[model samples]
Target: MDPRIDFLYLSEPDMIAAGVLDAKRCVEVCEETFALLGKGDYLMGGANHNNHGMNIVFPKETKFPNMPVAGPDRRFAAMPGYLGGRFDVCGNKWYGSNHANIEKGLPRSILTMMLNDKETGAPLALMSANLLSAARTGGVPGAAARHLVNKGAKVVSVVGCGPINKACFTAIMTQLEGVEKVVCFDLFLDKANEFARWVQGEYGVGAVGVDDTEAGFRDADVITVAASRLRPLYFEDEWIKQGATILVSGPFNTDESFLTSARIVYDHTALQEAYVEDAIASGNKEAYYSGVIGGPFFRLIDAGKLPALKDSTSLGDVVNGAKPGRADLKERVIFIACGMAVFDISWGFELLQNARARGIGQSLNLWERPHQG
Candidate 1:
């Protein structure tokens, strides 16, 4: 057997060429990944095997100047996981994020993904992952929309108006047909208008920008939240239409009137439970819960107001046919996912195969052969 190891290196353009921007395909792969996750065929970071990742968070006050102090959205995270089924591999999504990156003409978070061999530790591919991450992040909700959305959904309300939501819109539009309009809302009207115009240009949908958050939700069939964490986006019970699906990927706030009636679906229940366990053990459960999109529901679970974590429905279970997506029409539903590494690994594995098949990326040799040999 050849001892030499060479790994594929895919840059941003290569990733796009390799089909990383295919939201429909991303959703399909994410659905398969979710099924694997539901069948207990994956392992994430930490002992729980459901941990999101290990984050290097600098403190607010550090005595040494070289040791950087914490600022807005500054940290490094290593998310590692192994996925099973057709694509069985291990991988990690490593990223550095800082709110100040805009000053340097960089993205808030720059990411890369490394896929590895199951038996050997050598990498299969190392690729730029900004588009990969966005596609998967959007794909989860897109998958949820596939199984859970109300039939003939006509209008979609997009809150946040960021690039992530652009991908979400693409995936959802790919799955759900007859989408006639898109309402875009953001902290800045210019951003919202820009998103609306893009939607109109791409999909020929009657897209419009809205200044009022509530106005964005009115008469909408789907509401996607991927907004700022600094302030949780809140909605009134009256503003939301019946049978509307809310896909939350960021901070959110709404009254109990909606929660008591809405069926809350998780991306993966085990990960959220692991997060809850970690929070309780951290001795700051409230603050911990506050940091996540699912915090409100998880806190309610902790208080016994909501059902137990096991009792909750996950998108994975729905995909696996282990659980129903929706019980009845006119029952408002919310799907919340905090993101996971298995998604990156699965998609990365797929892109690697695609790129290899098409010979779309650079290949670098690790060694001619083992030095000892």
Candidate 2:
């Protein structure tokens, strides 16, 4: 047998060429992945097998001069997983994030993805993951929006106007019909205005930039929050229109009344289970989920104000028809997305196939043969 180990290296442009920018297709791929997740056909890091990823968790203070202290969205994490159900591939996405990178002309979170063979553990592909991650991140909520958003939703509010939300907005646009207008909310009016211009040009929707946070919520049929970590967007229950669905992919802060009353859904229950356990283990029960979009919901659960995580319907189960989504038009629903590696591995697997079929990516040899075998 030819004992050569080879893998594909896909650069950013190559990934784009492989249709990574096809938001509609990415959403379909995410839908399939979620169904697989609902079937219990996936493996991720940690004993629970559903961890989002493991973080470096830098200390708040360090004696050593070279050691880094934690900053906003600053951490390194390795997110690994194996996805089954026609994918049957193993992979991981490496995440390095620091908000300071913006000053250096770099993205806050620099990411790369690796795919391996399930049986042999041999490398299959290594590719740039910024777009891949963004697409899948957006695709999850996009998938949720399909089953959760109220019909004839006309206005979409984006809470964060950064690149992540840009990708999310793109994916969401593919699912929502008759979205006549887009309202972008951001701390910087210029950034919001720029994003609004892009939305108007790209999606042909009426777009406006709003400095007021309430404008992002009122009269909007769907609101997607992807604001930076720890930077929570807050609003009153009265601000959210009846039947509005909040798709939270980043930090959010709101009243307990909203949490207690809304029709809450999650990307996947198991991952959040891991998150809750991890947070409890940290000994600071309330610190971790503080500003996170879904954190407060978990907090209420711990306080016994909400149902157990198992009782809440997962977006996956809804996608697979095992549970319900948006039962009534007036149901105020909130779908919290705690980022997961399965989406990255699964989507990367799909794109790797496309790269292979189209003869894209560079083939490189890992070794001529095994050293001892």
Candidate 3:
């Protein structure tokens, strides 16, 4: 008897061919995953089973030989999870990141995803995860846009025009077909212009590089904030027009007044609540829930300013037709996507299947026989 194991390798281009980069499809899959997450049908890392990942950071003032210095955005991470439901696969995403890589003309992070069989814990596919990560990150917001953005939304604003934002824009457009103008704002003016150019070239839409956050926010029908800034990206509550939708993808510094009044929604309230509980358990009450966007929503719930988080629906509810989306043209809605590993695995598994069908991978044999025996 012969034993053989082969895994598919999906290059970025091959992923595109396999439809892994399709914003619309990615959004749909993420929506399904969100519903499963809401129903407690998933298991991530940590005792809580909702931890984002285990991060390893270097010391800030290390003087040891051959030891790396700790700096901004420099770290390694291991994100593992077992997602149930349709895909029903276990996987992990491991990556290392450093800000200095930008100067070397490379992405700040190099990442990989390992999909595994649920039964024997054998590896399925080891493929490039940068595209996987970006697509899923954007797909979360795309899922939100599908369920929340105003119909016929023509004007859009984007804060932090980076790789993540690029994918966000791609996903948002799938939901808002009438989007004809895109306004972009970044700390680096050049990066904003670059994002504008790409948008115009890709979709034939009018793209403008705006000077201020308010300018990006003003009168826009749909707004997405995907920035990586350590500080908060804020626009006065008065700046957002009625019926507009805002998709907050990263850390947000915003006034509580808007959060208390808006129709707030999240990808998974359980995960958001876990963060709130962690904040409380960590002994930092003031900044506990306030440090994260979801935390602020929870704080409002505690104060009775906002409705119960459970009442605030998930995008999956809308996708599954269990709840309504965009109640009216002028409803103010906010969707928070904290990101999850199940999303990556869902899309990654789909891509791997496609890669195999199209014969698009480099196979490496794991072993000719079982070493454990």
What digit string (tens of lDDT, one per residue) describes model 3 on residues 209-247?
Answer: 875777878898899988874566777788889989999
Candidate 2 colliding pairs:
none
Q: What lDDT does the true structure give each of the candidates? A: 0.90, 0.90, 0.82
Per residue, candidate 2 scores C-alpha lDDT tens digits across 237-347 of 988888999998987778999889999999998888888888888888678677345688888888899999988889889989999998899999999998888899888
- Looking at model 1, the pairs that clash are none
- Maximum-TM-score candidate: 1
Question: What is the Å distance of residue 332 in model 3 from its true position?
Answer: 0.4
* Local accuracy of candidate 1 as per-residue lDDT tens digits, 138-218: 998988899999888999999899888888878888888888888999888999999999988898879999878888777
Question: TM-scores of all models?
Answer: 0.98, 0.97, 0.92
Q: What value of lDDT does candidate 3 attain over all alpha carbons?
A: 0.82
